[model samples]
Target: MLQETRLIMGMPITICIAEGGAGARSMAEAFGYFDAVDRRFSTYKADSEISAMNAGRLCRDAISAEMREVLALAEKTRVDSDGYFDIRRPDGSLDPSGIVKGWAVRNAADLLREAGHRDFFVDAGGDIQADGVNEDGEEWRTGIRNPFAEDEIIGAVRLSNRGIATSGNYARGRHIYNPRQPGDELDDIVSMTIIGADVLEADRFATAACAMGADGIYFIEETAGLEGLMVNAAGISTQTSGFGAFEIQ
Candidate 1:
């Protein structure tokens, strides 16, 4: 088993490969991809593509293919979440951070798989895309962090060839807001976690649903092929009917 963790893109990204043949070369290449992503997408960086666009230095038509793809995905999320998942900030600047992390994780997993590493786990911050089994040849056990107490875990889920994402205010603190009502206080729910076919799918919906406050889990319950768990401000957790199926007992 090989595992490495690095602080990239403003978070601790951990990649673990269960297969014995996995090497430093593939791991380096994967981390390099994340570095490139940060350079191109980070709004905090002065020379990043996102910053350049925000500063009006780059034309929309001149943006890279990846930028265009992220923009399209953001727009789709906006529509799918009834405008609650917008990427535009109050200053009219675009911040696609919410979706980019998961997208990056998914791509990194693909890179590892392409390199013939089937049993691996890619976790960017708390968002995860796990494939195959762990070193013990068991499903990856993902612990959902408690929003009220960061060091504590509220629940655990078993996953293989699946993705999970958590959106919340505890770690980041009011980073995500309802675009429809920017001033609305999202005090009802502190965290929202979504499990989907892949990390990108789970992440985009998690961001939107968290912005929905307490109604987020209901939305997950209504959405097909998605399950969610929500922790409210009172430290009470609520989950969709199917979410129990993913629990690790």
Candidate 2:
């Protein structure tokens, strides 16, 4: 038997598992870990880890091993994407929204693993980490929303033991607010989705790559371990190496 539970991690989060008996309770316990971490580390919150770092109250030396890992990832992503995925705005405030959600989701998934749950899915907002097979003993199916057409799905992918993340201008609007442009207006790409082993890295890469516009698509293609599918403003779709694994529905 399969059971699903919804846990509040500041935002609503769903955990699905196939543990037969007590699956729901185990899923809830797994989500409890997420809630605790969300309260302590969520960058979206005003007093969270990144906020403390931005305020200079949380020294880099004081950062936990987990926080340090995510921060290091953010720094590496900034460099790899040529500053497209900056955690701080010009005002020096932290805006790690692009990466934090996926990071949290991945961590929550890890919690499930630690709890002895073998098959599960953790979704934080649009970011996801799916392990094992679904109800039909098949890979989980996830849809990629069409940025140009609201409520329409451009494609879907079936995955097992992998992560999938999408980035677009539709949610927050604008192309991730170009740091280089400052106050200048920015254009939005149709959508960009990436699949990889780590949802955290894939999420940040997708956002940064989309923010880079057409030029970043080439960079994404050259980057190793990451596969991307991008829809341009004109609705043309392009794929990076290994992106063909995604089935366009």
Candidate 3:
């Protein structure tokens, strides 16, 4: 097994590959994918396509194909989630951040798969995508940190050929907002973790659900191929019917 962690996209990008044939080369290529995504879509960098668009220097029709794809996906999530998942801020500026992080991570994982690696894990911050079993011959288990207890692991989820993303206001501090309630802050829910078919799906819904506060769990339960666990400000935990399936024993 080979494991590597590098600071990229303003966060630690950690990757683990099992049965690595050409370890260094494979990991380098994987990281390259992430770097490319960062260069193109990052909101922090002034030269990024996203930043340029926000600055009014780039028009929608002139944007790159990849940017168009991400925006479309963001719109779809907004409509599907009843405007809970939105990239457009209250200031009316476009921001595709809610969709890009998971999309980039998922694409990076795909790069590893195309290179003939099956058992691998890619984690960008808290979002994760894992294929095949772990080095222990079991599904990869990802921890769900307790919102109240910073150092404690309240629970964990086992994922294989799937993805998990946890969105919380505690860490980001009002980073994820609700378009439906533009000015108001979402304070009812502290944490929301989603399990989905892939990283993009999981991450988008997790952000949207977290923005919905306590009502996020109900939306998650009604959605197909998505399960969520929500922790309220009072520390009450609520989950969808299928959420327990991913929880590690």
The 0-to-1 C-alpha lDDT of every candidate, in the order given, reads 0.90, 0.73, 0.86
TM-score of 3: 0.90
Q: Candidate 1 residues 38-120, lDDT tens each?
A: 99999989999999999999999899999999999999999999899999999999999988999999999999999998888
Quote the positional error of residue 60 for candidate 1 in Å: 1.2
Clashes of 2: 0
Number of clashes recorded per candidate: 0, 0, 0
- The lDDT ranking, best first, is 1, 3, 2
Give candidate 1's error at residue 127 in angstroms. 0.3
Query: Tens digit of lDDT per residue, candidate 2, span 1-249?
Result: 565546455555767785556576666776777776676666667787766887788887898787777678789889988887888788876666567678878887887788787777887766788888887787788788786666898778887788878787554345443556543333445577888787786788888887877665677788888788887655678888677776655
lDDT of 1 at 8: 100
Best-fitting candidate, measured by TM-score? 1
Off by over 4 Å in 1: 171-187
lDDT of residue 170 for candidate 3: 67
Q: Could you tell me the lDDT of residue 220 within candidate 1?
A: 89
User: CA lDDT of 92 in candidate 1?
Assistant: 99
**217 Cα displacement, candidate 1 (Å):** 0.7
